[model samples]
Target: MFRIPASNNGLYLGSVPQSAAAKNGGTLITLDHDMATLPAVGRTLTVAELAEHVDDMAGRLWAAGIRPSERVAVHMSPGFDIYVLATAVARIGAVPVMLSPALEGESVAALLERLDRPHLLTDGAKLDGPLADFPVADLTDRTVVATGSRPGAVSLDDLAGAPRQQPVLLHPDEPALMTHTSGTTGLPKLVVHSARTLRGRFRPQERLASLVRKRETVAIHVSYVHSRMYLALAVLLPRAMPLVIMNDSEPAGVAELFAETRPGFIETHPNSFMEWEELVDHPRRPLANVRYFSTTFDAIHPSTMDRLLRASERRAPLFFQIYGQSECGPLVGRGYTRKNAHKADGRCLGFAMPGVTNFRLVSRNGARPSRDTPGYIEVSTAGRALTYFGEGERFDQQVHGGWWRGGDVGYRSGYGCLHLLDREVDVIPTIHSTLEVEDTVLGRLEELTELVVVAGPDQEPVPVVCTRNDRPLEAERWRAAVADLTPMAEPVQMPLTELPRTATMKIKRIELSQRLRTQEGRAS
Candidate 1:
């Protein structure tokens, strides 16, 4: 269904720069990772200049003996450089693999082994100890190309600096990038996607863009490894849309970023938004210019949606909470405004993205639910990844008749919107529905900052909560929050930042429970 050119670079880097410089070239991006220095110290590149950088980097990689389809891993700390080199790799018709910095060291090494020991392009620190345990044989043909010190590693800086060469265009079906799932549950799974698949997956950006006017600044704060790569290269770069990027989600840093860029549109992880919800009251009013807030990767907490939308100054601004998976792009999207965010409803994730996706709900006992019923969610999208890179059996198990089985548990609302309950693996057997209880608790307990209900060791319901304003958890308030509902274990209070989370910022219940167990053991 994708009619984009067969070029490995979806839109030529040269062409993108020309479009960017012509339309909106001045100060197109401000990348921030440090809170102390402010955005001024961060890299701010105009579109006119970034064009040269892309070409120069590609020429450097080519001169360094990189070739088309060579899988390369990017383990650099998140920054503007990751995007530059990633584009250069695709520009030269090579496949770039971005291993998440969130993956545990062994998980990172395990994924590397699965990729046939691809050339590693990263700063030396990650390779030093993370993969040290892997024998040289398993890491055979391994090469480390660094921008910093590494014994025997090639210096990217030492290569030729010419960028005038035109990028090579490969077949549309040629693989463009290989990435792994955010290892929230266990070891990450490798996923492969082709140029055509990437093009079709981000097709909705045009429509999503139409929601606001052109020439507006767009802000994005998600993993540099995720689908934002496509949005940055395919959608935003061409428009010369100004961007504000933050790898660090510390509220103070994000506040300063938006204070300067004053982003008109935002797309980030759901929990990241929750972490920044405190920015609503920052003196700068960082969200003042936000016309839309878009979230995906996981369902957002109700309180998070409530505060952020209310904070923005734009009249009738919208919140787009998308429910999707890493294996597939956006499946369903629901729009909420200040007026509707507080509307009494379960955790609704919205209807399918109309023509973009088809969803099915298969319930207990292996039957498709005839009505609104909680069950396993499955989706059919044009952009589903081709397969799990090396595990053919695992890939086969996830697909049936062109529909990929989603591991999430949810139901289709009577009006066609989808309401997610939780991950099937994260199911908590509460007397009341887990989502219902959580949403209700959030609505009643405005003082509660963050809440997650997980199954305790006895398969009983337990809650982990963060109180508003750093106040100690109040047993009376916790009891009152659940008084109208059902009796449950006392909430285990913890600092919000201490919660175990996936790369995308989804709470890792299994890991969090283990941490709590460890803390208890130490206390005893």
Candidate 2:
């Protein structure tokens, strides 16, 4: 068995592939789609080959005038190349600020302004689409297009074969990368991470990886801009597990790939897992080989977990649910087996990682924190981000005496499980937990593809429901499902695609609430 490398200083993304190659050069990495940056390389690669590509890209970036300590904002089209380009920027000791391609131009422009004119790496599609109205030149120091070029922009494709420079390692405490929050509330915050904090995030996940006793192909579908993507790679690569990185989350495509690869371990966004529930009954039995399934981005329904766990043919398959945010890495998590998955409570997000993470429930109004009066959840961990770029005071406001309150309000269970109720901003006075109602109703309604509870225009609880295939929801069925729960407004049925989502597929509850209010006003 391979042991995790000592990371006392921190993990440097520039050298991750190189370090992995040294341990297992032939370890294979499979991709669902081809890389736009290196189209000639094809879809399958080995760790050694991946290292060369990263090295080459680093050289091209250096040739284009990127220097240590400068910020390179990567806001290109969605693909595996996003991760490659980000690592290349880090190789030159420069900070790679990742902006989701899903972000609107206004938000992107605002973030770039906050960066104080950082270099931008984007493509033709974004420039001509959402960002069409923005003055690209004024919002950025330099615009480098990875796919198509503009007159004043630099073409990353043209920088091929530039001289490769030696890798530079920044101090462990120095800013190494920047990733944005989910932006569920409003504009996303650019979170700053040091190499040391990244190492802190890596250690707990490495321990989780150790649970697999044998070598297994690992499949991951994660947002390239999220810090979890890099940490997942860091954990799997050195262990030399065969890797499958998927760019498409379409159920049909996912089924075909999983059938071929038969990955033994899988980790993806919780919403993606919900979407993939249809694959459970596919003829290919795509999930049959999966020994472990995991989600860290959001709260997953027990029903979804049960469906997936039952699909796995492996002996005693496990589903690992980790509760975390962009500001901090995996804080608390628990694993579910087939025996208890169907009966599991969605709110009990499990306990902290034994030695690396710890959490507390701070009373909001001088009362005992419980299900009725949930307290603010705060955590103490080395994995916390340093500060929000250009918003130090905003970041400071969340940190109280070294413990970070991430705007979530929850309480600990009698047995020590952390029960996440709702985001502080999303809570409604009439409902104990909007999320809890959603979880219960969703568990009862198999037809629902998605369900979100938000405050209505009149302060009533509104349930926005999305059914599979956009089929009209049966009003009677929805009524039956929520009958035992608290009273709520008539369910608002909408297509899942129409719902506003963050890069991680989380519903923008606040935005949805406002939209509902606007629609109500328009109707009146």
Candidate 2 residue-pair clash tally: 0
RMSD of 2: 3.1
Clashes of 1: 0
The deviation in Å at residue 95 for candidate 2 is: 0.1
Residue 125 shift from truth in candidate 2, angstroms? 1.6
Query: Can you write out model 1's per-residue Cα lDDT over 1-524, one digit (the tens) per residue?
Result: 21346334343332455456666667467777532112233467677667666677778777767777788777665566676777777777777888876666777777778888777777655666566565533553445454654566767767745445566666666677877787767887878877666765776555566666656788888887876555555677666577777777888888888898889889898878877878989999999888889887777766778789889998878888877787887788778889878773646788776777889887765766543347778898877887888987898898988888878777787798777777777776654466667778877777776788777766777788887667887777778778877677888888887888777877888777667667767887
Error of 1 at 217 (Å): 1.3
TM-score of each: 0.91, 0.98
Model 2: worst 10 consecutive residues (lDDT sum) = 1-10
